[model samples]
Target chain A: MGVNTSGAAAYWNLERYAERVAFVDEQGGICRYGQLQSQVDEFRDQLPQKRQLMVMVSRQTVPSLVAYLGLLQAGHPFLLLDEKTPAEQRADFIERFRPARLIDATGQTIESTLLDSGLDENPTALVEDLALLLPTSGSSGVAKWVMLSYDNLQSNAASICEYQAIVPEDRAITSLPMAYSYGLSVINTHLLAGASLALSSASMMERPFWEQLREQSVTHLAAVPFQYELMERLRFRQQDWPALRLLTQAGGRLSETLAKAYTRYACEQGKQFFLMYGQTEATARMAYLAAHREPEKVPAIGRAIPGGQILLADTEGELVTQAGQPGEIRYRGPNVMLGYARTAQDLVAPERPQELATGDLAVLDESGVYRVTGRLSRILKMQGRRIDLDDLQHTLAAEGWSLLVTGEDDRLLVCLTPGQNSEALLQSLAGHTGIHRAYCHVFERDAFPLTPNGKPDYAQLKRMQHESAA
Target chain B: MKAENQILNTLFTQSLGIPSDLVTEDLAYNSLPQWDSTAHLQLVMALENHFGITLETEDMLDMSSVAKARSILEKYGVEWV
Candidate 1:
């Protein structure tokens, strides 16, 4: 079955099911899809014509979801801004996007008067039109706005549902922020399947969160690698989640050891652990490793999901058909984003409009399973030797140390929590990589800097490295 | 010599990446610019390392400030001047 073809009509159809529990917020307030759709219609009736909408929402599930769908139905290309974003960053985003309308949940609303003036109430586009503009996480550098069409999102969600067997009866918990592609996809795919969603915005470390998961009988739990590591440290045994049928990890690579441990736990408890891989450019998930085959197949990101293809290409851009050879991972699918919006040019430039050359380097094993080696951007050239910081981190982790390695133009710094011998780790890294210990600086930090999404904040690490070097 | 004061001083300085001299007895944890949740975890880790003791889950949550950390450490036989 296809998603509703007409945007307004499809939203109205979803409104009929609003009482069935569409979303539960962090405060435990539940909002039905129908009620949310009504809110969207109301906002649409009040929105101005020929103007963009910028929404600033907390990681809260319900309001964010409502704002997202409402903007889409209104045919306005809305920007999703993280509520936790620093005030300076938020100001920069507003200046860059120059959105005429802003929907903020935290404080008094700005631009509400402009929207309430009723500039345009006519629906200009169908549900198949482009719905939202998202800023790429840009972990490597400056962020860019990505335009994702309705067809792009719908096709991706349908493909995800087909591959994961997501059905109407299945329930998923929103673990990540709605501003992120991964979290947003969870909401879309689950809603598309007409499934229930248990919205709990609290971090996994919060005590009440675990209780809510059990209380809600959440079957599917999706999280980033950091959260999984936290779970490992917390000793989140299989027995702790008797009602959880599936657990998914993505947003970054989960350490092989932790993946193995979680896999073992899942097997003993008769649960499935899915190791997924994807990017915001692809609208969330592109590949998933089935639960029963983890750790042993731990490093493998598995094959592509329905409607996606993973191909390996050499540095020369030649297709690397040989197995176990490293190459840049490329994806071709309907879900590939329309293109990035260039604020400077005031134009959307579609990169590889048909195929996305995901700058991630990976190897296709003999069994056709893909293992991401590292990002091309992550490669650091130090003393005439190219080094992947991720490789260095994995090597350190193998030696029983958790470290986050970040590189400046000329120097590389490794940060680790206290209790790990910094000198010993540096020596081990030098001994293993044949790089001299002088090239590495070790900092015994209390914890690695994390982004709002819980991933390591490499940019902040780089800044810290620069300051320390100075 | 309150153990809480000593523990608070060390934890506030180390976890928040501030100089020991900056962490006064009257300083509140949340009131500091750098003493966010991440710094709180660092302080906990540093205290755990310094005292050679693992804090209980409840204690970890309650030990939000330097003063509270000191009191929590006292329960583990860590005495301050």
Candidate 2:
């Protein structure tokens, strides 16, 4: 149960618990721990050594996990591309990463001029060796690949398992995209603990999704805030999912109302609801709210997982120890990534061995709970005024309104649910924040656009806003 | 007169939620504002439904630009003039 010194060795140890279930894909196919290991070995034998491989997979599929494990076992650094990424983006990725080969189960077959190198017969990676190159979700703009090591992933998985008290037989459902750090972490931690995974390709809105969860007896569910919004819209009742035992949400803040509602439902159902917060840089989860305490202390992202330390520092980088004071959330842990990948130059020099200065602004409450305010980089300056779009959106969301804010050509546009008084909402926001009306414009839509990962599609939103303004 | 062009026009308009007039043979998917990943999936489904043929995954990925889409559809036996 100590920190795994090697990815392959850790997996080998976990395979001893191979009699336990490992994964159940959307097609109801079951992969036991032993079977998963065999597939990983098989995939490793099929891969080339010392060359980059691009894994293109649907979110939460068994093949995706197998491919990742295989790449690690073979000591080949791999890039994970979400199936939902456009072909244009994939082409761009192929060119930039120059992956020697691509493995896809999503049926995407790309032919590129990139060199195809032969596979290695025997390859191995140490715990400290690079394991993966994951691209940041980049909901804002251009995506950057974050380099992660085997030790980074192993430490984070072990810490998560320790925090959750995950057991061998626990069953988890794959809800988020596996290409995402949050979703991939769920697989790594669960499998590390010899748990079972139920994969369902259906979206949250689909009828088959809930039915599959109930049928598969999914004990753990990982989701983002948008899916929780859909669950609320569906008015999912506690009695409907008696088999559900734990629910975790991350990848953006869950609204206070939905959090309270889900917490109450979990409480009534005698299930645990975990409010988790993390980023790709941390290799998944850094902080999690314990399941027993929900709704009453809802906004907090809870405490750090084992082996991780979260400290808040003011704008000047001085550590803030006082509760309720906002500062940049800096993380120091083995799980923090090495650094980001640069297209033009060699990888940026790694940050000081253990600490990562997360760009998020947050506060630690009296209970030692962390609540993210906004990203420091997300702040926009327009017409001599500074604005935090996240703050503006959060304020509107608190009042039962949903909006996506973007700036195009020096004009800030607020995209909200259609037919609501756009001007009035803007006026109210201005009244509350003292923002000038001329600098802000409001556009209404029936539904705000969302990425496949369930985050707001700000890139697409900005484009639309620009076209409309033109 | 080409089935490939018809497929492209229909998919572009229907999936991207753009007017038919806006879709041209030279119009790239990302060049238009509304044609994003989500819309791309919708476009794929539309193509499958319209052609009554299951698109190979490779072809689906290759259908990025309108011209690329026409070529891919031609491989599927949909003729393009």
Candidate 3:
């Protein structure tokens, strides 16, 4: 079984793994590599022969996995969107991008009307290297997509396999949405390593998710900070699933308290715990704290991954040579995205070397590990999903509410003037923004505190959150 | 509604930001968009605070619906009217 070792090599040569298990269904049925290749081939044959753009409603299902490989193998660069995306948002993307086809979660493919009308008749107009497009902001209803090439995917996958030392025997259970870069990386890196995956959409809150984890003998598990919180609440330490070996965390910073707790568990149980950091711009991960570093660097996001460099530069664009000085974390790597795409025409934008400015503030420890201090942007991640506060504020203002939105990683606090209905406003914000109402809190004040420049004093607002929360 | 049901209803309404009338016994986790995983966590925290009892992992995971929640609460000595 010689590896293809070329562009998009994983999907291009699924047969190389032969009878090894590729996917474990929710019911614990195994689909070997040979059968998976056949399924991808059948699906590829059904797709349009010409290279084109497609939109796929992605789920952590085996059929969706098959469609993904089929699309990649057929050379169709598709946009992967969450199944929970609003119908209006999907329709808006369709109207703006005019994708040639739409593949629903059930693996049903529907050709667009534009395909028959001869609009943009040549699909090859897109950049030859473009392989996938992922939405930059899922909750904001923004249509900006991160354009990724086959090289970007391959390099990142290979790098991840190198650090994690994933083997053919590892079986990962999908706990995150495949639409997300972190989740998609789990699929890509595992398949590239000839490892098997258990496709389950059940969340950590559900008993079935744990049942499947034990049933499938899943070895590798990936989660975000919020999911780690849930696993804590779920008393993951009490579980006796012996096969669980590797645990990876990303998507956002895990609180120091939780990080230490997991580190202790991994040490006691003799398992690996990796605290990683990345943005969608860098494919999936740029750095991970090696497990051997342990309790000493429990919360630090360790060194840059293989084939990548993690550098910190101050706001003046000078490298911060001294330790303990915070700077914007930057990553230069082959996994950097081709660029961003706001329109269909932007897909053809030429490729160039990219260095991702990760808009995050972190300081270097004496040992060269990076400890993230805070965010440079007005964004917060609740339940592993990034929410842009500015975008959310605009959405609220459009609906006749002007308030100060500020919060930590776990919750969103909005300061409102008195006489506003807090419950109604919170409900509307959650419903419109797809942020759960539980994470949205409201505080009332006669007038908001202002900075010297008359801008809403975000520092004061954040202070108010503690007083109100207590 | 019984006093127990009323207390439960108030907690669900305030925590989930849903109307009290929608918090019926048949209301289940993941059934209402508001009663999602995050909301469920909030509800559990609220229950622990109100009942003054920490729920174990099995107790939390087994609490799937309003009816199931009441039964689980009873195990912690919460009485129903």
Candidate 4:
């Protein structure tokens, strides 16, 4: 997709990283960067049209990536639908995007929905500067598209590689979904650095995942918090991976306990654990706490990534420079997304401001680290006092409990794991807040509802809480 | 044998947190969303707790389907019908 001239040039040179092992598939198929560029060239040649907006359902990592590059080469602004999106939601997105073509993993057009002659009178002109469109979950729990230019993708990849100290020798695995920005970032960074990747769609819950990791000898893998929880439940440390050198976590807040536990486990296994923080608006990563830091630093999102700057802004929009003061996180970087798009017309607009007001509230410590206190919306008013649910959840998670918190105006409801009995925690929560035990309730669930991006689905939890209360 | 079937049936449903009606003899791991890797571990734990026998890692890997679980448990003297 043709973007601003400087941004377009950044993406135009594909052969710069044309030779290196990109990754191995489950069937022992190896993909190289050179081969990847060649595949993109081949696929672009076979494309039915040029510079058309296409919606694609990703398949296995390698194939999905090839088509992604193919779209870039063909100058088509593409929307990558989450592979895990349910059929109904998938239908909703396809209907909304109104792409010229809907392509499956195998590069086959599922169907052609040719728009009216006047719709996007110049199809390619619509995205002359936009290259990627990612789905972001809005505050009200709806999927909204975020527009990213070629600069956003390349700069983010370069910035990630810098902080992570990724090299051509690194072998990262596809532990996360390719459709999501984090997973896609891993692929991009590795390919950009002439490194390698190991692709498997099998989840951490399956045995094949372990088998594939062992056979391929992946040097690193990225995971969200819940995937770490699942691994902990399965006694992940019981097995050793001699080949693993790094473990990265992001997508949501990982509890201090889990973070420390994994950090220790990685240390024991002679590996580094990277705790990262990001949003799709920032193109996946904003900050990352590296492995060599002290254990206390594990809870902090560390500093902004190499090229990015983090500043705290209060309600009046003044910068808060004093340490220990909490305010909204404001991030400034080239990796920030161009803008957001709720409708197709929005895709054609110019870039948004490079500064992102990351709605997460954070306090900067004396050590130049940013510790997220809670989201601006996560504060709860209880018994004439304000309580941050993120704080409550953090405390609970730090105490080795898997949980979610929801509430009404007058009461609070906390949900824990089905097998865990939190009677003591429940009693303490009631007493600590001066709220009567009757006003606070504790329940359990087998699993918390997760959004398509794998974070806890607060919308679903709220519905369930009210439905049960009623 | 009847007692063993009763025990296994209870174990599968309870461990996987699925309805008893859904725990058919042919029900396999990964067949249902609920029967994931964690559920498999839970099932193994329930089997160990109920039968008073520990399974090797290979046996755990082999325990993908209910029939396979039954067969493995029988080796540990579960005597399922």
Candidate 5:
């Protein structure tokens, strides 16, 4: 890998691997590495001469892929957002980040806008090394993004390739959104390893997705916890998909029952099931359970990757040395992000310290594997989307509602303060978050239970929820 | 409104949080912000519970639009009239 003068990594120079297959679209259309390089080169040539900040609504398509690679090759830092983001959130992003350009695509046609008031006229300064920006929270419409330098992407990709033993012959499918850090890492690692990818927006629930998976002979498949559950319900047969050599699960904790089932299935079928733990702040992955140890079936996140250290710290910020003691998972690695960009000005800010506080509580087992116990943050991951409860509360407050909100995965409990229109509140909450109304349980409470310190008693709320259900 | 149409309409509005007016035959999954992958499963479960039918995986995936959902329900012996 080579680093150019403008801080972009030259690893994308795919000329030598000319005849190699780089991409296979949903229709089984092939795009060789040579053609990919030419497309990227042509796309890059059309961009502005000077590097500019951009916002791209990334999709699972060959054109979107080319745009991303083209932007990176041109040394232009761009914020990658999911195409599913709401119109209001997109507007908020443009207003907050002040990106010079917006790149979006419909089907295979790339649409771009070079804002008349781009950075040139009202320039919000950006660090020279910032190569990418990814939202910490999924389509939650939060402005917070993890800032990554070219080094962060390169290092994480290398570590993933080393751990997974990725080879050029391996082929992966775009099962997850490319805007997601985990999905983006898959693309990065495969490209760096000279492997190939199949680009498709079709989800696993669809028959075409399975047909394509079998047709493409995809060797690698990565999914979140929700998708895994769906696979079980759909009675997905592992033996039928013989081409699947590597199966990775992340995004959130897979339920105990599903975890055991998948682990046993992998062991019996002689397939690899790598349970990985990661966050966007760390660029993508922090730890993974090894495939060789698949038979253990214990809920463990295994160990840190090469060149990374996963340490645990207690409430007082003291290191937890003894096994079985729970503490916050802290990681120190080159893959750690430069810092977060909350507003336009923060884009040019200096990098934070190298250490990353994962806000996840876990314990080290006797076997040296880390098993997550709980989350210290008020964040819920509903179908791979990270929703910060406190942030949602703030959004509600801004809309003139006072509500006590809490919930586990797939369920969000919102206690409406008395005298508020319950119907109006429910619709507002559902509409604002883009979460299904069915997932929310809107209850009315005259007074909420509070702790001695005056904080909302969430445990009491959970009890009330169960009681109401009964 | 017919009892079955009302039931279906209630399911769509309640599960998706969209108004009844938006629950047209052309209204499709993934076309609305509220009816994403997360909402899709919840809608599936709601329809099953309300209609007292178990949808096969293929039918669940193929039930993309409101019209398609109605046809799938019809296949499972639900009357549209």
Candidate 6:
């Protein structure tokens, strides 16, 4: 494979780098640069000629990757679907969007003939500008997609490459699902920098994951906090990696103890450990704490990524310059999504808002590093006063116990590790907030439930409460 | 219905949201998408409440399948008819 770097190339132009190695498979088979280009071209030929909305169940495979790239190059904006999406949900989205073509798991284009394509009626205007439609969160549906332009993807990838110093020599393994924004952004940034990727469908719990990662000589890796916990459970620290250069944590907040442990491990091993934070609205990366400042084990999410700006907005929507006063974390960046899609018609004419009001509450310390406090909506109203559920959970967390806080209007359910009594935790909550013990329900669980994305599925816990109540 | 099957049926349906028909001897954790870690927790909590037996951490983590859960319950002195 000949990787040509003769001129500046748009990261997505597969044809431009026809000679480089784009992906390495589990069997150690290499998919070269030109192969991806040819595959993209082949996929482009298979699509229906007319411009219509597309719904793709994005799987992590050579065919899926090439088809996605092909559709993007052909200027087809698509809604990426998780494979686990239920049949009824799929039918509902199909009915709502009336997508012209349905790209099945095998990369076959099936004529969705369910309804007349909705986007085709006013096709000329919106189809030209839209590039991608990602879910606002894990559970978002047809009515809610974060509309992204090619510009949004390109700018966010550029920002990531800048902060992380990604070069053409870098290669990252696919640790997250391709349907996820964070995982998709890894593909975007690496492609922008003309880097390579080693794709794997295996979970970290398997021995094959490490064997293949080593075989591919993967250089950089990123994961959610729960993955690190899994790695710890798997005794990953004892295993040595000679080629790995950068290790990053995102998707959710890692505990200070684990963050410090990984940071120390990275520092001692001469590798860079990055603590990052972002929301789906602002692409994948918004803020990153660099490795140079690794003396403290507890890392703060550093300043905004190069192309973005982070500010603290008070209750009145005013910027707070002074430190320690917490407010909603506000991010203004080019990568901020082009508004949201409620219907098929909403896809046209980029409606990107200037500022993204991140629902997370955070405060800038004296050193200008932002420490996320809690979420605005993760609050519980108890005794006629608003109580921060995260703050209450942190009380148990401070006691070095792993727990999950979830409940309804009047009570909060705290699920904790088995064999341990929640009496202390319950008393502490009552002592701090003046809420009665009756309002708190404590159950014993071995550990918190992890979602598909490797974050604690607090939403699932809430659903359990509702289901049990019903 | 057998004592074990009845207890397992209610646990699988009401607690884990598994279809009552799908709750069988062959049902395994992660064997189906619906029986993920979250469902596993719900099943564990429900089993504890119904059987009046608290599962330890090691036992909870090791409850991988319906057969496995039944075997573990037997070890806890849960008699099966």
**Cα lDDT tens digits for candidate 4, B1-75:** 234477788989877766689988799877876676556766877888888888776677778888888888888
True-structure RMSD, every candidate: 9.9, 12.8, 2.8, 9.5, 3.1, 10.8
Please write out the lDDT profile of model 3 over residues A1-470, one tens digit for every residue: 11123543654468789789999898888899999999888887778766778889989997799998888777788889988777889888887778888999988899857633133466557777788888877555775788888878888999999999999999999999999999999999999999999999877888888889998899999999888888888879777769999999998888889888888888888899999998888998899997544568878999899999989999999999799999999899998999988878787665555688888899998888898888888887766677888888888888888688887877788999888888789778777566777677898888898999998788799897788778
Candidate 3, residue A185: lDDT: 94
Task: Give the RMSD in angstroms, all C-alphas superposed, for model 5.
Answer: 3.1
**Candidate closest to the true structure, highest DockQ:** 3
- Candidate 5 regions exceeding 4 Å error are A1-11, A106-125, A138-140, B1-3
Clashing pairs in 6: A2-A19, A3-A19, A18-A34
Model 6 residue A376 CA deviation in Å: 2.0
Standalone chain B TM-score for every prediction = 0.77, 0.80, 0.90, 0.91, 0.91, 0.85
Model 2 is docked with a DockQ of 0.03
For candidate 2, the TM-score is: 0.68
User: Best to worst by TM-score, what's the order?
Assistant: 3, 5, 4, 1, 6, 2
Better of 5 and 6 by TM-score: 5
Interface RMSD values for the candidates, listed in order?
Answer: 7.4, 12.8, 1.4, 8.6, 2.0, 8.7
True contacts kept of 2: 0.00
Model 2's C-alpha root-mean-square deviation from the true structure amounts to 12.8
The lDDT of model 6 is 0.73
Who wins the lDDT comparison?
3
Docking class of 4: acceptable
* Candidate 1 C-alpha lDDT tens digits along A11-79: 224665666766665566666667766766665565555634444554655555666666665556666
Candidate 2: chain B TM-score against the reference chain B: 0.80
Worst 10 residues of 6 chain A by lDDT: A1-10
Task: Give the number of the best model, judged by TM-score.
Answer: 3
lDDT tens readout by residue for model 1, B1-81: 235445667656656656698887556545654564445555666777777888776676566555666667889987777
Candidate 6, residues A1-470, lDDT tens digits: the string is: 11122224556787666778899877888887888888788888887666667888876677678877877777777888766666777788777667788887678888746845655766775646577677643221223677877777778888899988888889999887777778888888888777888877765644456777788889988887656765665456778888898888877677687888888888889888888888667877899887546445255787899889999998999998888899999999888888887667676665769998877788898887888877667755332234566766676577686788875545678777777767677666655554445557777666677899897788788776566557
